[model samples]
Target: MTESGVAAGFLTLVVVMGIGRFLYTPLLPLMLTEYGLRTEQAGFLASLNYVGYLAGAFAAGPLCHRFREFRVLVAGLLISCLTTAATGLSTDFVWVTAARLLAGIASALAFVAVSGLVLLIVARDGRENLTGLYYGGVGGGIVLTGLAALPTARIWGAGGTWILFGAVGATLSGVVLLLLQRHDEPRHSAATPRATLPWHPRFARLVIAYGLEGFGYIITGTFMVAAANATVGPTGAHLAWVVAGCAALPSAFLWSTAARRWGRLKPLVVAFFLQGAGIILPAALNGAAALFAGALLFGATFMGIVTLALSEGASYAPTARARIVGLMTGIYGIGQIVGPALAGYFSARTGTYHIAIFIASATVAAAGGLLIPDAFAHEQARERR
Candidate 1:
């Protein structure tokens, strides 16, 4: 495949994962009455999906070294489609959960493959710019589903929505696999026999921060659409997602431009603030405007934060970009796995998502502030040297 083809593959991969993954939240109300689920139970089932994703992230490097990335990518998508479609077929909690877990694993494998493929197609300078465009597909998928699937839920119900995605995912899996560009071995290939990196102090902090973003962001991912619906009623909630998806569509360009002018930390700090403000938007004013603004703020900055922070993290050890990013991705996945559980606990205790959402809001706010201290410290060290 050409560079353009590869970029399209990455976009398709994100869209497929988006379809199989977060497509559940807006349709949760139907799942609630259709399946007899409490709030905590519903949240727990969502975590089950992330659990599989966590496992897949950790396994990506070693598995690729053992086998081949293209094969892994194709199989993962096939499994994800089957599992996601089957998820709607069973109204039972256990069966629904089992399907979700499998779907998560499949999504993770394809994601890891596509991320690695970026370097194969684009050069180092271009990687930072491409990161947002690649990941932006997640938001794009949300927009597509929000506009289309939410309406489908009212008509054919959740089963039909899931069934449609299964076909789409299966088709894309084959298409992307065939379209994958042939490239030389990745320079930073973790699968290479000689590849290795010893974790250091600065890199450790970057990893921790990235995981924190995961902890904070997953709350929005799990509940943003639900919160919007609850705040202003269902008719407008899907439109809030439209705001998010559209805002997210351009985030890659916005963040990348900022990073280019001001440097990585500056844009990342701004992103954290955007997310924190957005997360708490509902509590301040429970209206359609507030919710829509929140979704736009959250969606616009969330993935860009991941792109900038992780790209900076990888630079600290450029020789191992794929592995280091994969490791951080796994750690981030762990935070996501825990995020839903924490949200579930708070929802159970307070009988609302407010406590959980606020907890997330505070976390990103602090993370943004933490970057200030880090910048000062780095400057001081440079002066002393």
Candidate 2:
């Protein structure tokens, strides 16, 4: 049951998050080429999705409290599959925007609900290490979608490709439903006393740093493929995204192991720095190799950052893991909301994503600096005194 639950949760995220939510990253370039969308418009559409994601995050808190987490997860999966398919049914910007927005909301609900359930299941079974495997589903989805897009784009074009992805997502969601049918909701014994971890300087720093991550990563996350297409060819862009997915697949596990050996903060600090470097590579060098290397670095660290940051935030308020995670996700969502549109707008005027990528890299580096040992050491000393 334990393994099944974890596997179900992992596959659910792969379908909902990987395909439903993020397939847009690779598809955005296609939309620009075959469809009639501009760079700025693509960014706007992406921002709308994030806005919907923020709404879904906010809704999940209350929805989970009122209903079963399993139901919410399933509903989210259904919604994501449907909306993803619906995106292909229209070329109208408004319709596509609305579909992406709803997909965003569904992806968020599925993500939050599944994450909580999986964590609960793992914690109960004492298989905490498996959590990395569960979270790694997002990367798996990215790799799947990126690789699939290469051939699909040639055969199907943008509209048909969206439909194809939707079909794939629906099929996977069905598999998840079957796996989770028996033990969807695991009951908790008793509630832990809510810890009142007041907002300290360190906590504030963590939140700010996480928000910076949202801003920094979304630029590349939203436009990396598009930028690669501009610099290299279509094939190079697709390969770059695939390389990113490949790098990302094991990132959570690698970072988790590193955290155990070296400590969470240090590993996270390094990840941020590496990610910053990754974010800038494509822009700095106009070559396929640089773009692929950059995507690999970006893929390797982005999800790792999410896992580490959320875990660290939960540690600060162990009794209120859901609340802490929600707050952090909301903050992160804000950064996402702003990033793509801003990048798109600047890129439209400047005719390149270099400036936006540079800014994003700087933001990521600053976020990493905040996680350095000295930054928190001073706070710890102050707390002791």
Best candidate per lDDT, number? Answer: 2
Q: Which residue pairs in candidate 2 have backbone atoms (N, alpha carbon, C) closer than 3 angstroms, thus clashing?
A: none
> Using Cα atoms with residue i matched to residue i, what is each candidate's TM-score against the true structure?
0.91, 0.93
List where candidate 1 sits over 4 angstroms from the true fold.
124-128, 182-191, 376-385
Give a tens-digit lDDT track for model 1, residues 248-294: 76786578777777767767878998899998897677777788778
The reply for model 2, stretches above 4 Å from the true place, is 182-198, 373-385
Q: Global lDDT of each model?
A: 0.74, 0.83
As a whole number from 0 to 100, the lDDT of residue 107 in candidate 2 is 87
